[model samples]
Target: MTTTQLAPISARAQFRPGLTPAGLVTVLLGAALPIIDFFIVNVALPTINADLHASTATLELVVAAYGIAYAVLLVVGGRLGDSFGRRRLFLTGLWLFTLTSLACGLAPTATTLVIARAAQGAASALLLPQVLSIIQATTSGEERSRALGLFGATGGLSTVVGQLAGGALVAADLFGTGWRPIFLVNVPIGLVVLVLARRLPESRAHNPLGVDRLGTVLLAVTLISLLLPLMEGRALGWPAWTIALLVVSPFAAAAFVHVERRMERQGGTPLLPPSVMRLPSVRSGLMVAVPFFAAFGSFMFVYAMTLQEGLHFGPLGAGGALTPMAVAYFTVSMLSSRLVARYGPKVVPVGGAIVVVGMVALLCTTLAAWPQVTILDLAPSMVAIGVGNGLAMTTLFRIVLSHVPTDLAGVGSGVMTTNQQTSLALGVAVLGSLYAGFSESLGTRDAFALVIGVVAVLAAIVTVTARRLPDPRV
Candidate 1:
């Protein structure tokens, strides 16, 4: 019997350097910190308000400032990484993030905390785009697939862990610190990541594009105009200024698009090239991302509220209730690459179907058990949701970035993350408002059920839309 020989690796495949295992770990760690910070404050807000004697408005600013700054600067951060060096910007951002985290921990007043939080968000913007850009630039084939999968898992798990850590830390109140430890904890971790990041391989575009000043301004205006109102409107009683900002957002977005298109036509580099957005994979992937992430965000918010208010779980208990989901998500995410390899992009729709089932289960459970529900009662549904989300999110990231060119990795990462952050904010704003309104009229149990039903419908949409995503390259 004759044995068939395997094909030889291509010159480009042989020459392309990949991240060392340690380097992959380091970048992933960097990725986790920003996402963790985003949700960490959710569980700590009440404690923060009590300790700082902060008003409701100030507390809202504390959250909004970070999110706004982070969202607004993400594209710029990606551009900087592509222009300068991914490794350099990663370190710069991490260093600044560390200092800001320290500042937040030591803040003497609510105003100071808000200022530090904004700085922290800006730092995150600088750091996050580099992770994806570096991964995209350095890795290939199975390595790239695995690295992206881990990145997705890190993001999902970090969201859950942030709240858990915050709840535990606040409940512990070590050194009589109250809510300060949540921010302070980042100091040691950031320092460690900074040290490990030294060994990371440096990567950047061969011919980097210069920053587009006008494009940046318009993009920021577009995001701020939209996000600020959505995030603050319900809380501020839908003020006239918020309404005006919302109205201005679409015009700002149109202007940004027109400017970008003109620059591209003139043979100049646009901040976000129209050519990239024209990719079928990128466009379709973003469609899935918006609703998937929106549902995930709203689910997290509503679940926490239900656990704490309706079922009367304390901070720790509420956080702990999510453990089954976290474990399931992490487990499935670790296996996502293998699954995708076997099943292709079909994995996404399968996952979305599972999510629909899980959400429906949750809705049913809430309706039936209501005031009598326990953490145990919620576990099965949580596990299903986690598994489904793990499968869908990991695959979605691969699908979106699969078509982005290596030279444009930074821009791609920035655009993807910006959409993600904006969607999350929108979810919290829209569904959160709906839940609050429904609760006033229908009570917490019925309101939660209704929201879960809505999420199920969104998941169904994901199941259908995911069919449009192109399969990853073999």
Candidate 2:
């Protein structure tokens, strides 16, 4: 594929030699770190609880804090990137994320670790939005498509690696670091990223508007209202406050929309521009993205629990079991751009079909094998899910950003990432809860089957939504 150099947006547009190989790898590494950290904590949580004497509630907070802060701040992070500069925000975010990670590793108490994780999540929000925005600002055409595909691949691989690596790291107990290596490992990688980020060409929105303080507050509150309750409610036994927050969430969301609309009418810059949503690509692509990621997020959560708890596998064994699927995912994701080129929007629906078939096959295999099922027995199902996920993720990412204007790249990316992150968290809350609830009554294997079945249904919805997407060439 040919590189598309950054087009001049104004007389002062920075000279960018498109995305250099080094520059692309640098930003993609930056993108992968936050995602890896998100799931890496799963295997380490037991060790953390034992080491820090953390209560169950505090342990849950350790995970939820990062996710809540990350989701709530993402849109604002995007706007900041647009208003200031993508490279500037990205570098700043990376630095903060590195430091916060260090704090997490060194914290002596659960509270301190929870606080540090929240800060790390905020830093991640800042770091992640700039990745796609930079790509959106710097490249176009086939170059843009390929970069997005790689971004999707990096995202997919990082989650799996986080699980496997987390287990391995904890087991190795490097330098007697115990669970600390997972966070500490980011220190060296972040420093390398810091050096490489200097080579990234800086870009910002032309005629960038002032930050929308009111809109930012409303949006953050709205997301927090919805996400906080969902993520923590089940763990906390559905407190009355959780119910209240859930009730208020819709109103908060409505208020956010009203505020943004008013800001747009007053000729102010909204966090998400009104016109951007008018693009058929944005609306339809997000419709599919939400369910696709929701299924994926919950599947990972539920599958990990099943492997460790129900199947009587240790952390290392559980993580290793997923390696085959990860391999399949990475391999297929590498080739997704070619598939998209051949099939256009049809690629998404085709991917959905594959995922359905995979889930059904896995369901059958799990039922037949039951207590004796091994990694090799589930290999075909894992490979099937990976291939389908690979195709859907890469192609859909390209479709969502394909039609966004360069000036709106930051906000557009923020919206897409926010949709994805929220759905992922929601998947854990809603679908994970369902699995937990079912496991109490039906036992582990049956509950897992039920969750997989639910995910397949969600994938079917993605197929239907994919039909509404505009042709990529449009």
Query: Looking at model 2, which ten-residue stretch has the lowest summed lDDT?
Result: 1-10
**Clash count list over all predictions:** 0, 0
What lDDT score is found at residue 202 in candidate 2?
89
Candidate 1 pairs with clashing backbones: none
TM-score of candidate 2 on Cα atoms, chains taken together: 0.86
Q: List runs of model 1 lying over 4 Å from the truth.
A: 1-25, 49-65, 107-115, 132-160, 195-204, 405-407
- lDDT tens readout by residue for model 1, 43-152: 67667777898744455567667866776677777778867888999999999999999999999999899899989988988888788777777788898888877776
Report the number of the highest-TM-score candidate: 2
Instruction: Give one digit per residue, the lDDT tens place, for model 2 in 1-474.
Output: 001112124334435557788899999999899988988887676678678987434555676678767766777776678678889999999999999999999998998998999999899878887887788778778888889778877877886788789889887888888889989999999999999999898888776557777766776677667766765677679899989988988898888888888888888867666677778899889889989988887787777667766776666777777767777777887887788787888988888888988889888998999888898888898889888888888788779888988756555666676677677767777777777678888999999999999999999999888888877866
Measured with C-alpha atoms, the lDDT of residue 57 in candidate 1 is 49
Top lDDT model: 1
Reference-based lDDT, each prediction: 0.80, 0.79
Off by over 4 Å in 2: 1-11, 14-25, 45-64, 107-114, 132-160, 175-177, 195-206
